[model samples]
Target chain A: AAGVIQSPRHLIKEKRETATLKCYPIPRHDTVYWYQQGPGQDPQFLISFYEKMQSDKGSIPDRFSAQQFSDYHSELNMSSLELGDSALYFCASSPRGSGRFGYTFGSGTRLTVV
Target chain B: QKEVEQDPGPLSVPEGAIVSLNCTYSNSAFQYFMWYRQYSRKGPELLMYTYSSGNKEDGRFTAQVDKSSKYISLFIRDSQPSDSATYLCAMSVPRNTGNQFYFGTGTSLTVIP
Candidate 1:
């Protein structure tokens, strides 16, 4: 089975720099979710999309924005980065768009802001 | 208060020991409960999931939900070192406003031989 795919397994950026992270959910899966996990903390929900439409939002910062394309893939764009933004970014997908069926996660992108 | 609470433990246990991990929640709308095991630097992997209340077992893992108490638990039997990982309890509502998943801080377990 194909799993969620996250690009740039590791990213490094300087404060005030900009970056873009990508996620390719499992084929045929229409829902995608983004989460940020800081060291020693649980994964925090950032935002989510269903069928190319933003369906929900979480603790995502104002400097960050995301959107799902018609292809069902999504991207997280961050600007004016800060050191606190350093963490592992995860993307999850569910076929039904509800996590009740269990969501599949990607390996994650480790972003380090210096 | 937080919607869900769990002990953030690097709870260590000897090999083959039975282990219990738990979480409590404040939301009554949460009907779908799930447990995920995450290895260091890896994505969380679903261990077991249960709906409403009662118990569900798969192999050496069992998931239990007490809807009346708003609490849930995961028990691992005859554990192995391979079982060492962070266990996170998560829940969601399947009806109104069901797109979000609430998670626990996770309890880290290390099974030693």
Candidate 2:
């Protein structure tokens, strides 16, 4: 499989500006996930989409939102960014109900909120 | 309390030495346990996964889960310098809502030649 693909491998934004990142899931996979990893920390769950509908959201603030397209592509949007928002963002894909074996991840997008 | 806890160590070991990594969780409902390895400035890669309580081995890596104690471990045999990286432990409970995976702060490992 070609695996998950993410766009804009690196991003820089000024405080209060908006940032958007994109992801394209592997072919035939219906579940997409987003995660954030700060320096020296583990990846934290952000949200997931399955069948073009939001399936779950983690402890992220309201400023963070995501959408899945008809083609199984996904986007993560950050509004009114703050310095603390700087981190690496990852997108992953998996087949529905496949449990642990379904998971496949993308190289992350590093964001620096100045 | 955080659902999962792990010792974030900059652990250094010699090549060919055995390495052990561990994590503890407070959520008794978790039934799926996993270990991931991440290189610096890259995405985390799945290493091993287990359901409930048991041991799973792949190549030189072994994963053990103990549901009764809410503990899990990953052991690396004949460790190589290429094994140097951060190890993260994660678990998930059965659910269709919200992010199911809960992760611990990773433990950093360095295998010295």
Q: Which predicted model would earn the best DockQ? A: 1
Give candidate 1 misplaced runs (Cα > 4 Å).
B94-98
DockQ of each: 0.64, 0.55
**Each model's TM-score, in the order given?**
0.97, 0.96
Stretches > 4 Å off in candidate 2? A100-102
The candidates score, on chain A by TM-score, as follows: 0.97, 0.96
Q: Which consecutive 10 residues in model 1 chain B have the weakest lDDT in total? A: B91-100
lDDT of 1: 0.91
Residue-wise C-alpha lDDT for candidate 1, range A2-92, written one tens digit per residue:
9999999999999999999999999999989999999978889999888898888899999999999999999999999999999999999
Tens digits of per-residue lDDT for model 2 on B1-113? 78999999989999999999999999888878889898888778888888857889999999999888889999999999999999989887878553388888999999999
TM-score of the A chain in candidate 1: the value is: 0.97
Task: List model 1 lDDT by residue over B5-106, tens digit each.
Answer: 999998999999999999999999887899999999998998888886888999999999999999999999999999999999988765443457888999
